[model samples]
Target: MALLPAAVPALRAENLSKRFSTTLAVDDLSLTVPTGEVFGFLGPNGAGKSTTIRLLLGLLRPTHGAAWIFDDPVADVARAHRHLAYVPADVALWPAFTGQECLDLLAGVGPGTDLAYRDELVARFGLEPGRRARTYSTGNRQKVALVAAFATRAPLLVLDEPTSGLDPLMEREFRRCIAEAAERGQTVFLSSHKLVEVEAVCSRVGILRTGRLVEVAGLEELRRLRRTEVTVDLSRPAPRLRGLADLPGVTDLRWASGLQFTLSLVGPPGPVLRALGETDVARIDVREPSLEEIFLDYYGEVSA
Candidate 1:
């Protein structure tokens, strides 16, 4: 495929920073999102993720540096935004209007006359098109907003905690929509405090703290920090197990709920697993840390 006329990032924040009074909302944050991949903007509460998104959308100006969407400045977002769509965390459609009417109104916002799959989207979201937006539940409103956003076939989708109010069934449907969008070459920038959702859908994640980007890598790479749980289920008492935790790349070593003990180890598992091989092994399950577990360590360090 030929290169695009401009080699700009699908989305970018170059040393972007923002300040509100004494608070530094975003501090020297930088990230480059390539085309055709889902990049999850991850952080705990008050990590400046939303503030950065607002800057990217030209809803708010950065105190320093610049915001770019498809090589164009934030000031030029309108000109370049025909290809962009945003589903804010709060879905605030007009209360008096129906779901179909909201879609109609958004259709006027862009070139979406030929929404061939609009009906399909309504069915998939299980939304009643005739129902008033205000009467809908939170999850229903999210679906209504999502159907409107995805139906546009925009080249870029900026979803801020898109699944926040969604039920499990709706979340499953939402994931499918995002997956299909990526398969069709749409770039997705998902901002969320929910790490589990990010771990499930994002190809890569960028973690922010105190308004600065602290880490950016594939979810698997982040999980690599606490990989290889070397557990030893002893038939008899082995008093030395707890003492060996600091041997090398070991952390969170403890006896779990029942018969199994868990230890997350780094490096070639040969040494650790080999050492465990000598013990009477009941079972061993080595895997990556959960997103919650990873964030606990990650945020603890940054916040400290």
Candidate 2:
């Protein structure tokens, strides 16, 4: 129902830039996450992901750019933030207090927190409300932080590597919870390196490399841009030198044995498959490249 009055973008960053004394942390990046979705923010280490988040939260000023939330300029972030909840990568809570105490403290910071929902999270996250923060494990502490954040029914949730210390079951819980939130028209900006999570939760993604955005689109669209792997099997040793590498969309070839070989395939498999048709093949296999490989095109080993 994007046509609805509330269907406009919940978060937008246009030409957002930030700088240090000798480095540009964020450089002319622009992206928009519409209502009722989870948008993934991905980038490598030292890619200015954190810096950008700080800018959006008004924790830092932009060098030359603008940010908006719910159609309001970031200069009024304090007002816009009432509709947003931020879950930082690090768990920020007092070490000598019970779980309930920390959530109560967070509740005091904003509106929408209720005792009923707060109690629900204590159980949902498997946290012992009576236990102090110092007695909790890293993952448990993370759970407390999330419980505090999600307990607020904020329309926009800005998460930075939120599941860093969660267990598999908790991560699954988080995915289900986020999906439920989206069903209710809540917007999520999930920042992380977890490809699988993004693939499962986000409706679209924006890739940041060296403080700049290079791509923004649906998950399937990004996957289409990545290379595919084609494995061919033969009964015995490989044939003499062939024109395999020169074929259209063929790259990074590897010969496992006389009977097996693998190569990267881009575009439709027709051309390469047709060319290899001349060889005697027992079995054929094809699969999409890993998300890491696809992302590598943006955040490669070297900085952009």
Candidate 3:
């Protein structure tokens, strides 16, 4: 078999840590985002997601360890930023400038911006370029920032809850844009609490807990950490599912009706399937646990 080429690293962190007086804002964190991959950084409030981003952006000096953008040390902020664009959770624009003016100013200052692409983004985002920044709503301000970032030909995009202010329609648009960006070979480091967005778009996710990275895996791999919900319907009066619940992976067995029952299974399905095969099985429905459920499981363990 031919070996696939190794992916180039767009962002790399090694034992990165940060401190604010007595508080350790970010613990020894190490991770890598390969070029063109949409990597999700997930955590609850104050889980060091923001702090880690700042460190990657070189806005804060790491107390220990180091990070790089396209192999350029983040300590060299100007050089690293040349290859990346960032959109913050709370966008603040110059109120005195028109939306178009802000876009132009940002493009002029940023490296390798594509004006033609910017125009397309403006149209797609439904932005009013003529309106002053003060006249735009929160979502509109966010759109302005998003347009600037996405329109750029930057190698890396660091988005901190980029869809926070967008409505459902616009949020869908944002996801579409992200997919397009990834298709164009841009690496997106998305930090968000929105599990749905991550599950929909990200190839892999890293979970942070109280400044520590507790888990990092692909979506399918993470799903395995949780349970599967099974709903069984019996053709006749349900046979006593003796020792079924006692199986290693089964839990929360409940009989919803004379012919229906629901149970959750935590591991391989081989044992469960064999047991179900012995009964007069009419129908069976199995659902994998969602990313949110898996996140909660890891979160509960970390909290404990």
Candidate 4:
């Protein structure tokens, strides 16, 4: 028999909140991420996602409650950071230093770094180490930061919009690296606005609205709340086909021509499937809603 891995808390927050003067950046937020999990933190502009990341990184003090990384209080930056690596949304580098020099400096200051792995990442990310920092583009700068962070061999990775400037190919590489990190027993705390990327890489996600957490669940669970789109073509014209719209979980019915129509559906297909069986169906197509669609539903509800 194989032994199962023990449950451990890689990151935890208890009623964590932050305020700057009269503005409340985070509101009574609390969350826990288990070891070896890739957790997504999702929100739109001004949603306090960045503030929460800062609080966990010990860059900002919480106005209420507390946060911890591997049992070490986040208030102690030196001790807490020893177990994690961080990559910010906006990466800035010294203009005078070459990319290689910057990497060396970062590796020297971090807890522990794998020089061989760092070299492999540099090649995989297609970074020009000899180029001066001032000569690098936004994407290249981001690559430098990614290489340095991944080389640290830390137990946890805190990434905020880590793929902001990468092109499609590089973005694919980044996702592959994240999967490899998970295999190595490293936890990833990903804060991203790219819904597709989050849906592809994260096992669980938490949604935030107006500095407050509104929902947290696995992707499959969240998908249940979203509507699906179904388009169908009938063998013959039937004016009564519109009556199918009256079925439960069906909405936004529209006709394309004499025998074709489209509608939005929610929940199980059993009800819709039975209704279609009654008609002489020629063709049918169904598509699951994207994460972006579900996120918009939450955002719209909050805005209203």
Q: Which 10 consecutive positions of candidate 4 have the poorest summed lDDT?
A: 1-10
lDDT per residue, candidate 3, 203-249, as tens digits? 99998877888888899975555678899999987466756888887
TM-score of 1: 0.80
Number of clashes in every candidate structure? 0, 2, 0, 0
Estimate, for each residue in 199-288, the C-alpha lDDT of model 2 and write its tens digit: 789989887777888778898775565688888887656465256888777888888876788998777778776766676778989887
Tens digit per residue, CA lDDT, model 4, 1-304: 1111337589999999998898888988899999889999987666788889999888999999899888789999999888888999999998899999999999888878889989999999999999999999999999999999988888899999889999999999999989988888888999986667887889998888768887888998755656889999999987877797888888889999989999889778888888788889999999866555666664565531
Q: Determine which window of 10 residues in candidate 3 has minimal summed lDDT.
A: 1-10
My TM-score estimates for the predictions, one after another, are 0.80, 0.80, 0.78, 0.81
**Residue 258 lDDT, candidate 3, scale 0-100:** 79
For all candidates in order, the CA lDDT equals: 0.77, 0.78, 0.85, 0.86
Model 2 score (lDDT)? 0.78
| TM-score (C-alpha, index-matched) for candidate 2 | 0.80
**Model 2 segments more than 4 A misplaced:** 1-8, 225-251, 256-260, 265-293, 297-304
Put down candidate 1 lDDT per residue, 6-30, tens digits, no spaces: 3557887788888898888988888
How big is the RMSD of model 1? Answer: 4.6
Model 3, total clashes: 0
